[model samples]
Target: MISMDEFIEFVRGGPLGPIKKWGTKWSLWPVHLVTACCGAELAHAFACGYDGERIGALNYGIARQTNLIIVEGAITRKMAKVLRITWEQMPDPKFVIVMGACGLQGGIFWNGYHMVKPSDVVPVDFFIPGCPPTPEALLRGIRQLQFKIETGEAKTSATFPEVPLEAGRKPRVLPKSPKKISKAPAVIVNAPKEVDWEFGQKLVEEIKAKVEAKSVTITGKNRIAVKVESDYIPRAAMRLREMGFDHVKNVNVIDVPNEDKFIVEYHFSSYSVKELMPVIVNVFADIPRENPRVKSLASMFPSADYMEREMHDFFGVIFEGNPWMGRKFLLAPDAPEFPLRKDFKLEEEVYVR
Candidate 1:
């Protein structure tokens, strides 16, 4: 009269319990999911030198075919979705092991705007701590997962020695940074440089004549900087297009909080002209930081569309005429609004004993 579910549970907890554990421990298949730089170590562990497969864990590329997931490195805001989806696709009785210092607690990228903890997205069974852990450390993590599977208890690979502290001694205070942090971001994007490219001199003269720029200076051999007012951004882009800069390589925004301005830069390069291919003309301008708005170059150069959307997501800068503005393009839907702003606060962590 017992149900099938009850019968299965009975078998699992009954005499066949050890058999199930033994089978699961030896055949741990970790799905391939590389979110950051820690992937290199994972590869090193499985490669010919280390041969991690000898221990029964194999790295599978497809999610449905695996029961274990090894999340490698920093999971950014956008990457959280992928991690969740992959975890969901796997069959039940699955396990997760997050490796690297970034996955554990953000490591060097502590308090970063886009960093996401892997445990936030899935049920992590174990964590392998290291900036980029040695291949041996990764293999040991696999063994820990296996031990957990066989015995229903997770074990630490290493234990630290307890150091005795001096009695009644005051804690030493470290000195603060000698340099004062600037209220505004200090970025030297357009420092003037001297170079000996004969073609660059002619090109500078041509750009000055065509584009209405505050100053047209050749920053380097293959670099030219054109500073313009916010209102003249679209016009300057159009004039540059007429010359030979057919595409926008990148669209960047610098948030200067103290100055109350945002510097919008468009790096333009050419595919149509052979001579202009090596030249990168940076057309940049300043706009009010409070409510920054710049004309979209998407219509003129389609590549600027995605970068423009990314800038809006980061700094809340409005790219006027861009169809995809004011939407979460590069970050997760629940990510903090305008996270790249100087005043944006990160979630604080609490340590409990």
Candidate 2:
């Protein structure tokens, strides 16, 4: 039996070759596979302002019916699998156009642990380079693909002339890298310094009166650090809840492997109280890195539910009462376990000279 590539070549070599190519070129329906922030640019391209349909490419829903895949922005390790699966479901004579610098390389997240290049997972026909490429650039990429289809050859829309260097001029020298990577950087999760604030002073007094805090310090403007033992977090959370901290703004876990501890902080704020809107109280505690366990504050602040699960996924910290404990939340099933932990290193890349 002939393969899909062979069948396509036969069709192209037959009497209806021009007709097939023309039809395919003009009828490029792209399946929506938005993986990241670059989706914003893709939306602008198809929206009323750009009207990408003018070029004969319509953004469709299903993978089987579409002939093109525009991979938008950063394809995470998790999204790469989905990208491959989507490509497999597309019909024969399918093409791929990877958009943004993230799709080509890693863009801003070049050294990120979760980032995966789209090109590594799928056969990309064209790559549009930008943090997020402009709508015009995306449309131009579509045009380039269409040209490749009809003419069976790739052509650039622009050309540049080569310039010779002057006789006494030397080649440009790149400056040395300024980043000083430390093997063991001192990780100070909470070393509180005093800040002057009248409201902060009053707030600290109120917290001291209500909750049994290990230490209360005004970290910055509108920011307060309330330290407590791991066992007392739930109690502290309960007190904060009563004090009008209705929501958990953020749940953060800092892995201090050098110190053999993990700092868990739940930033709390209130939507009900207008005065508390800008105030962020960080309720933090340090737990042994080897046996990281903390009482879940989800019961007190229901908004901490997903945040706790995410922290569980990244740092392998057990939030005792959270139902999603021991289960994956934000990270993929096959992704490296406890990836955000300082001890968990990403796979190193080697560039060929």
Candidate 3:
């Protein structure tokens, strides 16, 4: 079997060169690899309103059958591997068109630890610049790629004049550090003032009667904050379950490096009881940051399973009894561990002309 480059050369050198180029140009099938928000623009380009098929290019499903890969937006470090794998699976003579500013040099996520340039991962044929490139811009990129295939020469659709900087005016530089993690940021997780809600007050009283809470306060109209010792979280969760707080809405971990502790909170709500639907109960505790481990409430609230895994991924908090503990759930296998922690700093980016 001839290689992709050999086949391309054969077609170009043969008498049917024009025909082969024409056919290939018109039948560009882009595999679906929507990586971020820019995918919305790509969708708009191919949707009924834009009718991208009018140019003979159609969005295909399988990478094996497609000839083009349209990278929709921000390609993170995790997604770069997927992009490379998908590109390798395609047949020879494959093309790539990257859309969005994120694909070029990281765009808004320039300082993000996870952001990766699409060009660094694949041989790009064209780049459409936009936070989320417009549908028209994406289609234009397709047209440019088609022109390159037929003419055997690459051409940009548009060009702009170079702006000159004033003499002795140095280019602005990004700070070496991107984030300023506070050494001792004041964390007011359950600082309660006052709220005039009879039902909330009654609910707080009822919770105090059942659970051994450190403090129970009505933080808002339908919200109650319950402070508890890390060891008593399971008991608090059990009491809340009995009170009809059927599900866990969110599980969060706030890292306080100065205090050497992690503030873990589980926001619970109810769908079984009508009156409790709007009420959100926050059960929280501070655990030692060095060995942040909490008893998993998954046994009581099945809905907390995924949220627990997410918290475990971000803060490296061990949610004991959760089956996915010590394993990556939401992050890529190669992603940095505990990236969301306050001390994990992103690499500084320097722009070059």
| Number of the top lDDT candidate | 3
Quote the lDDT for 45 in model 1: 94
lDDT (10s digit) by residue, model 2, range 185-230: 7865456666777888899999999888888888888989999989
- Sum up the clashes in candidate 2: 0
Superposition error at 154 for model 3 (Å): 2.5
Model 3 vs. true fold: TM: 0.85
Evaluated at residue 236, the lDDT of candidate 2 is 89
Could you tell me the lDDT of residue 312 within candidate 3?
95
lDDT of 1 by residue, 1-353 (tens): 99999898986788888888888889889996887788999999999999999999999989998999999888887888899999999987799999999999888887798888999999999999988988999999889988998888888979899999899989776654454555654766678887889999999999999998899988888999999999999899999999989999999998888878889999999999999999999999989987899999898889999999999999999999999987788788888899888778765555443
Clashing pairs in 1: none
Better of 1 and 3 by lDDT: 3
lDDT for residue 184 in candidate 3, whole number 0-100: 79
lDDT by residue (307-339, candidate 3, tens digit) is 999999989999999999989988888788999
- Report clashes for each candidate as comma-separated counts: 0, 0, 0
In order of TM-score, best first, we have 1, 3, 2
Residue range with the least summed lDDT across 10 consecutive positions in model 1: 176-185
